[model samples]
Target: MAPSSPPLPQFEEAKSTTSTVLWQLYHHRPRSPRAIALSVLTFFVLLYMLNTSSSQSEPNFWTKFPSQHPFPERPEDAQVALPQRNDITINDTLPHDLEKPNPQLHILLPAQRSSRGSCRTITSAMILGYPPPTLIGYGHEAHGTTDFEQMVGRMKRTLAYLEHSRTVKDRDIVLLVDSEDVFFQLPPQVLVTRFQNILRKNNKDLLRKYGVTTVNRPGPKTAPAVVQKYTQRVLFGASKKCHGAHATDPGCVSIPESSLPPDVYGWKTDIHPDGFLNRPRWLNPGTVIGQAADLRLIFKEALRIIEQRQKKNGDEEAFTQIYGRQEVVRELERRRTVSLFKEWGYKLLGISDATNISTINIRLETEHRYEYGIGVDFESELFFNQLLSADDVEWLKYSNVTKTSALQGSMGVPREHRLLLPTDVAALPNPFNYSLLALNQTTLPLWNKTLDKLPNPEDHTWNDIPLMTNAHSASVPVLAHVNGNTKLRNTWWEKMWFFPWARALLRRYVRASQGFDAAQSSLLGGADWWDMRGGRGGVWTDHESWVRFADVCQGQERDLFDDDLGPWGKENGDPDEPVYNEWGNLVYGKEPPQLPQPPQLNDINDHW
Candidate 1:
């Protein structure tokens, strides 16, 4: 229409070029505003959803599972159970074969010796007189008996049970004696043999003077007046009387009711003293010369004492005047010293040299005089159990050493009442012999192999010496290797420089959970505010200053860099002036320098 455009470029040619250009524009053009906005909105929505879901999830996901699932509820309880018994098997007949044939066995329960009774004084004399295998006493009377009868009784029972279960012959019988109430623990056969030997060894004159035609029995006439004096002294002491003889000057020894300690007149102290004065002096009846007859002797002696006391007093109430059955039992307990009995048994058995064995006092109130045994290694606990069960004896089981009873509250029933044989001694792992050898011989070689592959050998220098030098060298790329392979990365330089440094920082964070100290230095990249000038490149400061400055700039990077470039970056006044050369050499040496440019308004106000 405007001169027909001269069909200027020929419509077809123009159209072809236009189509090619249009095709390029279609692929290369910037996206539309609406499309860009939609993409950004979608991304934001996805990010928000991810954050919300993560926050909503349970913190302890594993615990949320059903109880029927077999996952361990507690970390400590997950340890695998250890083997109960060892592979070594022992024959039961071995103990019998080792023992001599038909050796007579004897169980001796010494007469009860009470703190307040005649037996008590006798026991003290015997203990003071003899060496090993000395006489000890135990009785049935409460106040006149040993102090630790329950403990001694349990030990006797334990030994007897063991011997009987082992099918040991009567001749092989071991003498079991109580310390306070009885004197000797020798079996009848052993006692007879020993007595014969003694008689042979003693001179005729000595035998006539000391030996008796018949075993002399102590009675009222034999009882020394000194014993009564001592008894009165004890009574006075218990009553807190600092002066006077108790029986000779009764009023002098008697304290006013208000002055007496609480329960001074109770059966425990006063009544027992009175019983000692009233009861007829009798011979130690539990003293017997027979095998397997200790308990029987004790019972007989107790009955004899009770009967004698009743007859001597000639009153129907004579028995009540001294003590009831409970008091008799207590008297027996007072004289019984289980430790002494155990020591005597050990001396007699010839098994005292074993280093790992220890005989402890086990108090069993339910049983009569029988109480001590060896503590075995924990590894032998099951074996001990097997032996005991086969022997027809009950084992006392305790939850722990501190508890008084075997069973626990609401947990479950205990196994049984038995002595504990801890295998902890035998099963203990030897760290010096085993664990050290493994670490030095095996693990160290593996670690060395990995170190050999590092690209930079200088980095290994830190591994061989102090860590600080290594950390300094590692800060420079040229001096230290940053290998991609983790095994290679674990070289000495990496470990000493990075790992320890990182670990220290992690520890700080962990400790922060408890409490934190603000004065500690940062472990991240070095500081920027402290004017550190000797770091990796000439661009940064020295290690110490950089570390310090980095700590100051802990959360504010932009502010730190801005401050450095502003007032902190200047020489005297203006930053544009070059006071020194690029090599850090002063251009004017000692001379004062002149400013190269006028101070800008921004430099004066904005920098400040």
Candidate 2:
């Protein structure tokens, strides 16, 4: 009651007096310009320190951002979505030419000599309905002293050729393989379909593991995180060992573990002396498949690294470093992003511990260049590296259920075969499981009925032509790299299903009509075996004109065909000639043309 009586004097006056006293205290004396400036400077310094502390680097003067900046400072700005399979619209970006149907496949084989191995490679590809290969470095002499140096030289020349080719486009899928050791077992259609499918599935898994996230852009409001994901755009054949780098190097130790099942190789996984049971986690440059642009970028960077380091064994090492650096930078970015979001109280986000630490010390200026979209074929689906895996594959007729059944409970069969047959061991009409491929499904239930429906269907049924299947992973690889043992090259080449009827197969492949059966095309996702170089399959030589298949492969009859095996139509009383085109023209009609003389070399060192 007493306080109320006093307040009646002036409630409003008391409030005004209190406000005036506070204002006077705040501005008892005029603030100096230096004091105001100092206060502002302190606030900004604290903000800069906060940002720089995350990257452990000084802010760049020009950009005012940390060197090797993993991601944008604002978490909201990191949202990135994976590109859809159908979203790739290369046709629109290419130079319009109605005359040319966009070629989807390009094969790159680098060989200095047309040896038995090289001839067999060319012959096998032709037999399997592949377009003519661009024989890179064919006319060049061996450059370096060591095998490694020669390998690097071949890589350099191949890079040069791809860069110069007008026919090759950014979107085209390119297959690069070791000329002498690699063999094409499947048709172009199977290779392309499997490639696209592998990439699709691998990318989908990656997106689920790394691409999804939520972040606050401006404030409390959240948005889907668009983090730049690591995709397996360019896939190289995987190896049991990281060939070129040291054991402790990031290339050898820091790569994401192989995606194969943990028990893929059983108890002897990494301990096997033969390395047959080891997981294929390392990169093998012998066989690579990727988009033209992606391959070009990787090779370009590899060449740069070679020149900078003057490395003799740089081919695989350079590639391994590139991949390792990519993983390292990606890991840094991932760690930075996680730390930033965690600071903002984000929890429950999944982070992978696949790679714990990286020994790679990537240069700050070149951090952006490490992203070459590199990956390895861990399952040996598209490319099989035979470095330490000589006994892993078998030539069995997948369509013949009896072949697998015969070995099921037999003691004479290898232990691996007796354990479990590969997933692709059985007949598979729908190999890819793609619904679109079922458009023109046929009555025959065998996989790749296209091969079965050849000229003499009975003479060369699906049972006759076997395919190479990887026993451990149950994969029918597109191609095989016979790298470890040179002695096995001829034996394995003979084991190929088409080897027995190479002449007949090559004839059938070359003379195939403009369009494949609609059913076959549907199975191949509209891909053709020979659509490159205007459908006249041949080798792109150093000469002005492209060399036809007959020119490069005519003389190597022994390498290309098995005389003892005879022809496919032998039961019908063999045709007049061993090889004849669909129009009854002799497959090897003319004398093989002389190869173009190699350009004069100033010196061995100068050529590379």
Candidate 3:
């Protein structure tokens, strides 16, 4: 047997193969049972460590900030890690890029309004006004007085901050809106998606004019997701009607008419009236959205125009005069004409027309709620037409021709004060009298069902928001802008606590922050008062659900109507102290001891 084995194994190939196998095993792996087990254990241990490392799995900054202040959720939370400056930036703590841009969709708000009382209430209203406030919190707030930075300056500064932000990529869309008076009901993603749909349904031919040789190159992309991917650089909110024959269609939106000359909207304000332009299309400074780099170009050009022409015309109106000129130049590019804003350092990356944006809606009101009372300063003539349609709320929003403090419609509210509130609340009040607003027709809603699935549904927060829609389509509105006085008491929205859908959203907010007690003093946050940090604050992100189980406002020792920390003290004792009225409602003072003056001291009759 030994002689036969030796003859078989003597072959050179067999000998070499055995030697190679033994060499590899000896050098690359342990052959012992204990050593092999230990090697397997060591491999698993390293992998476990890597999987749990801070880089792989991290906590939500939304809930992390309150427990630990000042520090970021991660070292790289701020894109560039620049030191914060309160005087120049939004706050002394947050960096320009506090959030990571998964893809794109940047919301920017400029609040130069006074950081005062009812403004705080209105601000809170705007924040809570969104069906799910969570869809919004990731926006920006541009602060400081407007006196130093005119409208143009404010917009430019904010654009500059965004342009340089790490969160912004070349393709990201930057949407500029007035935070004070505006309520965002849909996710920013939906806004962009709708904007794209409007273009496909209306601006296809218009892009051809801008040298898009292919014009929807791949041809027909009807899917919402597909259209959103190809949307243009700029999308302006429609202030004037763009459709002639197809105005009321549900899915098709008529953007600013493509048949008209480029000189009809935005910066091109010089064309003679009449024709398509006769109707006067405008890019209301109210909202403007575009690519980050493109937006930077816009703001930069606007600032240069302001610096060049500030002496000729006030800095405030300069931006309005030159707002849409970039569109004009793009038109010139289409026509192969000379450019004014300079085509250098800029590429025509999908710059396009004003599209009528779509929003979402939920029909909740069934009984048609109404209010009327004596000496009630919070009077609202807010009534909706077409009672069964969800668009009734939109009729209320688009119908308003009255301006908020943004345009100086009130006595003491310096438009900036309405914009400057510490919590960005100043930007939400509509100084324009709600009673005088010219309510409009129904605007389309969006596709997102964010409001459909209520948050913390197991709890009682449903009072704040209820089942608004059984079928959410284009006919409803997702947000409501309460442009009236809510400071004296929870005015317009307070009663919605029992609205057909959900009312607890606002009432719960007041109860949580003791906003009712603080209502007498929300403008000036008191010693124990918590600042929402302008809707972006920790209170909303961390404790909004606290109202479900606990009376969050219980321990606070805030005094109602305290002058130093109050909106108005007992000065002149005319407006009475915060007192319960005949209907068990809180009021400014009882009937004035002195005969009520006609205007300022006038008595109001509002019924609920």
Candidate 4:
């Protein structure tokens, strides 16, 4: 019909175009039916080939597994093995004989408190430690105490310990005194070497040449002068008896009475018994020397004198009088006899008329009052002041101030100040002026009451704490000095009590906090949270922590931070954030978190 209306030409053309486009789109867009079918067939072939290769490479499970069989046994052969020992003996005598000579000097100190002042006298012909004639102190104790026996005992123990530890030999003996005033600061080793050289040649000759002095002149008489000369000769070793060869042998040689020379006996001169040349106030007991054989004789004679004194007086009286004037005189006599021993010949020296060795006059005066024992003055304050100067004082003050504000702080006060004003300034005992109004009134028991109130073992943690330990586990010696007057009591308390307590407190605090470990805290970022939390809560906190906490509590950190990091992070904007936090915690977060806002500039301005 009209060629089917020409199939509505536009519609028919549109339909045909749509069908062709659909067919092309279907064919180009992924896989069509033919492609999919080929893909499936290819996948199947690949899988089959893979399965076949695997089967070919792998062992069959149905086949029996191979078993490992034991090898044929071989005949055993027996053999004997015996233990052997090659004995060898070593002889100690050969090594002992080959030991090298020890040259370390052994100094023996035997201090005794005497009436003059604390003194140290050198006995070695060879000067050691410090030279003879060295003026070390004026008239004060080396240590505060004047108990000579106690000093000697301590010195003996110290020396014994030193000797054992240092491996010192027995022959190199040198005796020292604790008396600071007695030791002269000179080239001691030089003097010692000179003395040793002289002794090596002719000990008596050197002593006679060096020992002569104008003091202690002999009376102008034949027999007395002869005896005096003989005494001087024996004492100074101007005579031959001082030599080791004849020291023990009294029958070796004798000075004929007729042949005694005038100068040999005594020379007329003024006696200046003020300095070292004169007898010292205190003498070291160990300086007294005698031959091995003569030691027993001297001991016997000393015992005889002691016995005589005991017989005359009761036991207590005899004991008390042992170190008295009579005993001193007997000791002098016994010393003379000991001097006769060949071994002691070195002690005697020839008196020299040329050298005028001047003795130093020490004038010690206290502006406040005579406090403790006069001997204590040397080591207490007077001597220290003499030795120290204005520059030293200033240096010490600056050092202490600087140290106290440092990270570690100061360790108590300077040693000199501790020795001087030992007690607290507020606790200082009132100075007493001898009241003419109440001169006869019994002094109020102020000193005793004050001492009773003073700090003791029960008052501090270090009261019974031991400062040292030895092989025997003995505690370090504790000493105390009690004075008869107010001044003495004050000095003793200050030096012995207050200073030591202060030092102990500092030391104990330091030792206790030194081993603190900050890593034990279980916090994010492994922070030192104790510091951030104001250093409180646990018992494991250290001194630095407490100091930090105290500073923070006192609002010191605001002042510090205000000057250092400024006040930008005081409020808002994540105070724990790395950029904002002044104390350096980055990951700190509160459990119930709040939204963070930008920091306000006004906050910093307010701080300013």
- Candidate of highest lDDT: 2
Give TM per candidate.
Answer: 0.15, 0.65, 0.34, 0.20
Global CA lDDT of candidate 4, please? Answer: 0.24
Model 4 TM-score, 2 decimals = 0.20
Question: Which parts of model 3 are misplaced by more than 4 Å?
Answer: 1-101, 112-153, 187-189, 210-231, 240-280, 311-324, 330-608
Model 2: residue 366 alpha-carbon error in angstroms: 5.1
Model 4, residue 105: C-alpha shift (Å): 0.9
* Higher-TM-score candidate of 1 and 3: 3
Clashes of 4: 28
Evaluated at residue 200, the lDDT of candidate 2 is 74
Residue runs of model 4 more than 4 Å from their true location after superposition = 1-100, 110-168, 201-267, 270-608
lDDT of 3 by residue, 1-608 (tens): 55644445458788899999999988995479988899999998866553442422433221221111111121111121112223422224433434322234444545433223223323343334211121122222345635434555555557556555554566554555554444333223234444444434334444343332221233486432212111233444333322221233211232233332333223433243422222223333445555565556546645665676544333323334333222322332332321212222123443534233343121212222110000000000111111122211221121123522222232222222231111221122321111111121111111113221224433333212321210111122223333332351233333332222222223233223422223222222221122223232212211123111112112111221121321221122333344553576644344436765574333344321
Rank list by lDDT? 2, 3, 1, 4
Candidate maximizing TM-score:
2
Model 1 stretches with alpha carbons more than 4 Å out: 1-100, 104-193, 196-289, 293-608
lDDT, candidate 1, 429-454, per-residue tens: 21111122222221111112222122
Q: Tell me the tens digit of each residue's lDDT in model 2 across 532-600.
A: 344443677533247755556555665667564333323234233234445755443344467987676
Compared with the true structure, the alpha-carbon lDDT of candidate 1 equals 0.25
Question: How accurate locally is residue 27 in candidate 3, as Cα lDDT from 0 to 100?
Answer: 90
Local distance difference test, each candidate: 0.25, 0.63, 0.32, 0.24
